[model samples]
Target chain A: MPGFAANKVENILDEGIEKGGAKLDNKQIEDVIKSVLDTETGERLKIYVDTCVHCGLCSDACHHFLSMGRDPKYSPAGKVKRTLGEIFRKKGKVSPEFIKSASIIASTECNVCRRCSMYCPFGIDVAYMMKVVRRICHKLGVTALYIQDTAHSHSVTMNQMWVKEDEWVDTLQWQEEEAQAEFPKLRIPLEKEGAEIMYSVIAPEPKFQAQLIYQAAIIMNTAGIDWTMPATPGWDNSDMAMYTGDFEIMGRLKRSHFDTAARLKVKKIVMGECGHAFRSVYDVGNRWLGWKRPPVPIIHALEFYYDLLKAGKIKIREKYKKSVTLHDPCNVIRGGGLADKSRYVVNALCDNFIEMHPNREHNYCCNAGGGVINCGPPFKNKRMVSNKVKADQLIATGAEVLLSPCHNCYSGLEDIIGHYKINMEIKFISDIIYEVMEKPA
Target chain B: MHDLYNFVRGPLAWTAFFIFIAGSLYRIIKMFVMIKKKESFVFTFWSWKYSLRSIMHWLIPFGTVNMRMHPFMTIVTFIFHICLIIVPFFLFSHNVLWDESWNISCWSIPDPVADIMTIIVVLCIIFFLVRRLKEPEVRFLSTASDYFLLAIVALPFLTGFIAYHQWSSYQFWLILHILTGEIMLMAIPFTRLSHMLFAPFTRGYAGSEFGGVCHSRDW
Candidate 1:
């Protein structure tokens, strides 16, 4: 009920205006738009803006709307109508005060979840619309501190969490050591040339969830697959910069990631289950660098695991026996077309599965995704409320375990599940598989 | 008075017919052209099938997703849409035009059923309008355009109801109904109501094909 209230709208708007109440000179607004419009990316942004018809069909597709108790102000169409529409109507002459409000709507509110675009009659991608809004905010230096902090970390350290070079290798070694306790001969196989796979993960693996790295090592080593994780900066695949709309730093982060793989001379990159990172490496980053496709093919862990099972590289000792539901992370399921593989992986690993009613692309978002959680505790209460639909969906599944295939999905789902006290365990696919996979001779 | 009503109705009916035909076709065709312009020209029917399944979940019961989350509202909205769709196509006035245009005729609805269905649709519209105004979340979402569209739609039904009751001169009410109907037809292609035509294709394209790539395409 705390999250279901709409009373905060007026207060949020008023406080936002007051915080950024300084009137902008015409010259400032003119200068900001001029700087952005001068680039080739600006041309694409302009075309996208010109195409929208402002149909409100996308309103219901947003979880924020449902989570905010069906507030239209939280709708994707409404967000655009408030920010980009205003800016476009005013011919890019918006003041700094207006930009501040636009920043909150873009950064903290919309999750770039693309659900609204599905409901958009014209297929106008409102996710892209929000990203462009964030881009403007990024340029105006109005980004959320926590998310932007990650982006800044990416810029300086070439990883979202400021994971240092030595610390990355040390974490891998530590994980390998923990994994070796399971299989003494197991090696993490760092910098191994011509390896069949170059495994990558987001910076958080080293910074927070190193056990995932440990679990993956056991799976890879036990399965006897030829894989190597890089001992360098690009080793971290997660890019909060992509979410912050800092394409400059996003490209740099992606370049480091791909470069790490290419430098290792691996056949391909098999990345961990982080949706945005997958999008950055395989789509946005590649596009930013002017490649139609990733120069080196990048496979999501879903696809990689699916391939591993299909190829009989590993046999299942037993299927996980929890009644589990799958949480679809937007980037992989919708943006990258990996829904089938995700399902394949889930089915391969889980025994008793209760499919979430609106499973796959129609699945509700875990509010912590899109770097919303990265915005920090200041917005956590709001973030928790914004995920009400997701909580309801999970509760409806009546499953004891939730198997999210992507890292961001894991984080978001974990937060939502905890907030609701739904008595469900959240985990990655690799953890379950590692527990049950039969070791090769 | 009859002659004046005849003049107004005849021209307005023709205008409504042409607008409905031209505007709907133009909007549908624009969608096709846009799809053709995407990187790959091929249309994947398999993905389209998946999308169709999801959309049909709203209509057909095929072990599809549940609408239980907002059960009451979903049902109400569903009924409202069905009436809006069926009445426009199968009501007496539309059926008369159908006979004239194609020389194909269908049976008219029974009087009681027709009256109930019309009344239900009118009531649903009013209920929706009231909800939009009374709920703060809905109120924040409602635009002047939303209210204006509702008024435009309510006009034809209100005038027709008055004509049915014979409270106002039948000729004048019928003429007013015909005029409001014409305006709604013209506006349909340009407004959010266009989702009626485009929702299927949009869902299909994003849901099925794009579904494979990302963990969820809800973005």
Candidate 2:
């Protein structure tokens, strides 16, 4: 636990303090200043730092602020003031005490959801600002353990979960077997060249939630979509390297995923229900690799569902009986722009749809994501408390079930809902559709 | 009097038009090229589809529908924009220039509609100004440029309205309008108001591709 000083998290914090904080010798400060602020880009960074208006409109949008009983200091603006503000004011001449506090604020306090940007009259992206703080912390080598560990896995195995190549194949085959039990003829086809779609997923699907893969396969089989799952290294698309700000590893993970798709020569890639993973392939990773856009197109699960419904490839034998509301995943919804289509899918699948007030791009974030929840048990309480706004929104929707499209949102919403003791079932959109859609003969 | 106004108007009109067109084009083209070279959100189509859902949203229906998804702001925004757009394009003096420039004859809205729109727009501006002051959230996020932007916009309208009413023995209301208009045109490229060009692009690309990645319907 971070509360214990000798823990790994604390060690990383101490290391950051030792390297960049005031405890550093004169030579260390010189090195730190040279490394961070001597570049030409430093001028532009300075302008951005000085431009903030100190308006705290970004507070309620932050799960950390809301969860912490509306503590003003936890707001995005306040976090910036305490960390980035101090650094800028001191010209990055921050002390060891400052670095320790900065580490705690960046690593544990913020989830980097861009919801605040929407509410910003100027559309200032506060999330980007927080990420810059995290980047500084990262350069100091002080990222949270679980997410950093995942990034290491991505660097070593080219997948976030350290999923071995053979094991990745076996898992698909295993899921295919399981799906066949539900729909006996169902197949999780692998490496079928010229397939229309190549299905990819995060490592967690195999590591913790193989049944999601099984459901997706069954849905595809029933829809008769020409999709194949890769048998090798690029099979997993989720990249924790992104959240850890390990741009180099993030780029490598993305390259392999894209290269695999290119090798298989699939027309397009369809990723599983993971928001951050979609953002990785679509935005950050590709940009880091110097591509303006992905070489091959990528489609998220929400788009896939909408396509299936529109094409009549999949038919709902009966509407889901439950009243359900949709939780927009920040990366896919706010970042990717899937707000309405998510609603369309929800409406198509469910009989009763109650709009979560402030739904769509304007919707609140599930604070568990952006690797905040991945900080593990030490920070679980903080994560739960930080997302009170989201919990309230979910409760107000008055729906018996919530259909969230992204994996992070699914897990995060589940944890928050449970923590708050809200009476609702958190489900993936596919989970409901898979149950109700008529399987092919 | 018309001749004197026309002389100043000819060069001023061209300057404003040139700045508006060239500056807006430069910003739009730059953003388009940038987005074209970047990655598409996995849910781009879905967002595009929804953003396009209400044609009315993109084209303000005016008094026909005052309340849209954004509520009070939407209505006020529509009024301000409509007045800001129409007054400059279809004002009586502007129409005279139109006749001289292209030999294209058109009519300004009759006094009633024009006055109503102008009043509505001015009222909205006042409401926004007051709202900014009254609402903590709005006040918190606002910058020096934000208040300056509102002033720049409202100054022309206020001066133009005063000149129309001839509220005082003023020599420079029309001149003030032209100067303010010029300032706004020049500022358009540099300010957050540059969103007039960039907003559509960012929204279109970010929202469109985002929809695709989320597996939602495009638009």
Candidate 3:
């Protein structure tokens, strides 16, 4: 239990406390905790609490524990103890300082990756417990400021980055024009009713990584897939609100995204290489809206690539000759079960595919998902340090390239590679496939 | 003293058995009742199959993903839980007691084997105690109740071992052994020991959710 000294950087929790400290009195904080514990959660909460033996077996499963010099406080069980256990112990009459610490623990410290859940002897969802802490924190308006701002963007513009409607359409048009240079007949269809797929992506794709959309356009056109991009709001599938525990905005965002697909009369939704977005639409948001499953069938980009490769729709001209390793995004592999298919897609496009130790569902997280990276620059040093385990995992592969199929993992890995000087190039599956695939005549 | 022995061996045993069964049933039933219902928007496929598969998957010793992570602990825990359940139910003395009380009899392990198993259980308990104390993560998560439960589980075997060896007051050790066994039985449904009953449910639910929807091959 030695102190884990923070590097020289502004801590988001301290800032959140300074700003949101007086917003909630002791009575209000207690009331919020009581209401959430009593009403929001049911047998799941009670059973998990009663069943945990505190064996600490899940400690190794967490990246924070391993990367931060095996600090016990960073372990999944310790995080739960610091937040939920304290709440139950004090009967929710915790001080403002406790709430501030709890918010930091729930929001920034843990990624809600659920890899620890996979490792729990009793399958206790520590991520779910962390989200419960986040729910309480959200009620008190004590969420990390940057992630809260992203959630606000979801509220106002139906996207995390607040790309206006015209800007979104313009990005698609620009990508379409770029793709047409490769295949003159290629077009990025917009709001085309009855299309086979409604392609959706996070707002960052347009704001920053527009080439991904350009790549998608090329792939879709080359494969002759009937796909459309929504011209209206709801094209962005990412949900910061879900991570922030703002279920109201999360629900609206999900509903609008699904409703957009329905309005377009598309058969299914094909989301980009984003993990949290897939989880939000298929699991958390759908469940919140009383749907046991998503109303529309949504396939992640990994699955989409696998299907295309398997169906002979997108043929590989020559496998990319690089010693590449795959970073399994927790949402898609552990959360969505696309491990085998992801490998299939990777092997099909890459010549020398090396396996990372503890690959697939057992793989370490990219330290980005669950809004940890979205907590923004103030917390970058913390994120990088906590991701040291991942850097070592990637380094051990001795692969020249790291192929991550999720946007958050891509960004997170980029940061890790640069910080650790790991001499690796990171690319998404689409980036590789687009380079190596046989273009339609 | 004769009355106390009979009460501890007879009425107290039956009462503990009743509480154990009833309390366990109540906990499991209440868990199911408390789960909120939701309608599936898409057709759910092979949910029951996945749940059953998950339950069977984790039931085998060292079969879980977590168990594989720590090999030494897995081996020790596998031996410990097997001995924990088997030595109690299949011990020769327990089978004899059952036959005398209700004309019921079952297979029993030999005396020497049962004794060996009890020793292994005691060793495992000590190992676990050391682990809780030494491992910083485990030490942080360990509560008074966690330590108390470990002691509660170890008491019966320890007292039984002493009574069988006739190393101390035989009658007193015997009485303590039976009393501690009854206490463990009553505590099972209320403490973390309830994992004996709920592990299957939690593991199964997790398996079903992952396999059915996520199509994850977590097991």
What TM-score results for chain B in every one of the models? 0.84, 0.78, 0.92
lDDT of 2 by residue, A120-239 (tens): 333444566667666666666666667777878888888878788888888888988877777788889899999999999999998889989999998888888899988888888887
lDDT of 1 by residue, A1-441 (tens): 673444443334433233433544557765766666554233224434444434345667788987876777888878887888788778888878778788878877888877666655445667877887787777666776677778888888888787888988998899888877777888998888889899888888888999988888877876678999887677888889888878888888788887888888888998988888888888778877767568889988888899888888878989999898888887787777777887887888888888996767777787777878887766776777777898999999899999888787787788888889998998888888877888754
- Write the candidate numbers in order of decreasing DockQ: 3, 1, 2
Candidate 3 deviant stretches above 4 angstroms: A1-14, B36-46
TM-score of each: 0.76, 0.69, 0.96
- Residue A422, model 2: lDDT of 93
Tens digits of per-residue lDDT for model 2 on B1-219? 555466446787678878888987876565445434442322233355644432224454432122333466756776677787887777776688689879878878776677677777778878878877876545645567778887877777777777777777454677676667777887776665665654444344333443444333221
Local error of candidate 3 at A340, Å? 1.8
Top of the candidates by lDDT: 3
Residue A317 miss distance in model 2 (angstroms): 1.1
CAPRI class of candidate 1: incorrect
lDDT for each candidate structure: 0.74, 0.71, 0.89
Which tens-of-lDDT digit does each residue in B1-219 have in candidate 3? 778899998899999999999999999877766663321221243267777777776767677777777889999988999999999999999999989988999999999999999999999999999999999999999999999999999999999999999997899999999999999999999999998888877777777777887788546
- How high is the lDDT of residue A236 in model 2? 87
Show where candidate 1 strays beyond 4 Å: A1-95, A114-126, A164-184, A231-233, A251-267, A282-297, A306-312, A315-330, A333-364, A384-405, A411-427, A432-441, B1-68, B71-117, B161-167, B208-219
